[model samples]
Target: MKNELLQIGPVTIYGYGLMIALGILAAYMVVVHRAKSRRIDPSHISSLTIWSVLFGFIAAKLLYWITQWNNIIEDPRLLLELSGGFVVYGGIIGGILAGYVYCKKKNLNFLQSLDLFVPSIALAQGFGRIGCLLAGCCYGEETNHWLGITFHESHYAPNGVKLMPTQIFESVFSFALFFLLLYIAKRKKPDGFVASLYLLFYSLGRFVIEFYRGDIIRGSVGLFSTSQLIAVLVFLATCAILISRWIKSNRVSHT
Candidate 1:
């Protein structure tokens, strides 16, 4: 759980940040390969990847600041400490919005682009979670289970005891989702179908995983966590898209 991966001179590389960069690079490679296979313009993949990373980082920081506004206002220095603090939901929302706008401006097929990128996003998320594990952030509650991982002497670990390895669990889950989506991609289904399924499943996974997290809870509305609130919104949006597609398909079939 050591945060610093390496230090050379005045520059110190943090494991979390390094892992995030690696994840983005991995996702970019996957997207490029897929784009080539689909006969889509491969050049657009680089542009999209760059935009996604830039916007995604901004969104993550913005959302984290919003959630911890009181602390951030009291101590503005927290912003300088990029070793920790980021919300995945914000990145997803921002990346999708940016990608949609980019596709529209270029007169590209937005749904198809989303379908192509969904799995790559999942793969990136999986690697990012590994970074979280190494940094000891996004940790889980203390447990005596066999799966508990100790993060003693870690800056991100609150207590010097073993805890559930929630980060690893999430990483594995996201990787599984990535492969599942990749397998489904071979079927060549509807335009938004892959993206919709990704949203639904990822939201469900996040909702369940939030319960294991021991981080400061931002309180919940009714029975839902703050993450669950976002997940519900995503799930509903996916459902709406699927329903609209179904209606359109039915009409086309009837005609």
Candidate 2:
């Protein structure tokens, strides 16, 4: 894996950072296009995006610090390290929370806003996972299969090992989910259905992916990894939301 993708005198570009930049740009474009279709104020989206980017970075860094609390206790300077160790779920949570607050303050329809962003979020995740691949951050376990990817002098994964290309697998899955969500959006089922389904599908996929994740920094409790625990909780929450919506619909129809 190569972190430094390109470099010139007094300037350098990192693979991970570049992928993230591209992902954000692509996601914002999708958001703007979708917002126009939904009749949402594009200016509101622009403002919310500023909040999302700020809070997402902070949350990602905060969670990473929490995961490495022991090291930080030993050396506080590690907290300022501007490279690697970010948790994707943390960023999503932070970004969503920021959006929620912004919507509330702006008196916007939360579910509709979610509908506009979920597909974009999925697309962004797909690209972000490719960044993980290039940085060798979220690597997969060893495998003897020819399809496995090998790295040399990676910052995280073991070098010279044929690992399951889990990053690529997750990237493909995210993209598939993105298309599915977008297609479902076209059907216009109900408010929040697409968003909830996005959460359910992503949580389930992430839970399974945790099994193949080679890194130990992901933190675990009992038999479940941190992300797995989150996935289970989010899955249950999504189920509750869907069931409640169904019950409400039934009651409204009966009335």
Task: Judging by TM-score against the true structure, name the best candidate.
Answer: 2
Q: What are the RMSDs of all candidates, in order?
A: 1.7, 1.3
Model 1 lDDT, full chain set = 0.87
- Looking at model 1, how many pairs of residues clash? 0
Q: Residue-wise lDDT of candidate 1 within 25-102, one digit each (tens)?
A: 898888888898889887788888888778987897788778788887899998897746888998998999999999
Q: Which parts of model 1 have CA positions greater than 4 angstroms off?
A: 217-223
Work out the TM-score per prediction: 0.94, 0.95
Candidate 2 lDDT tens digits, 49-138: 889878988898888788778888999988778776777788888988999999999999878888888898899899999999889988
lDDT of 2: 0.88
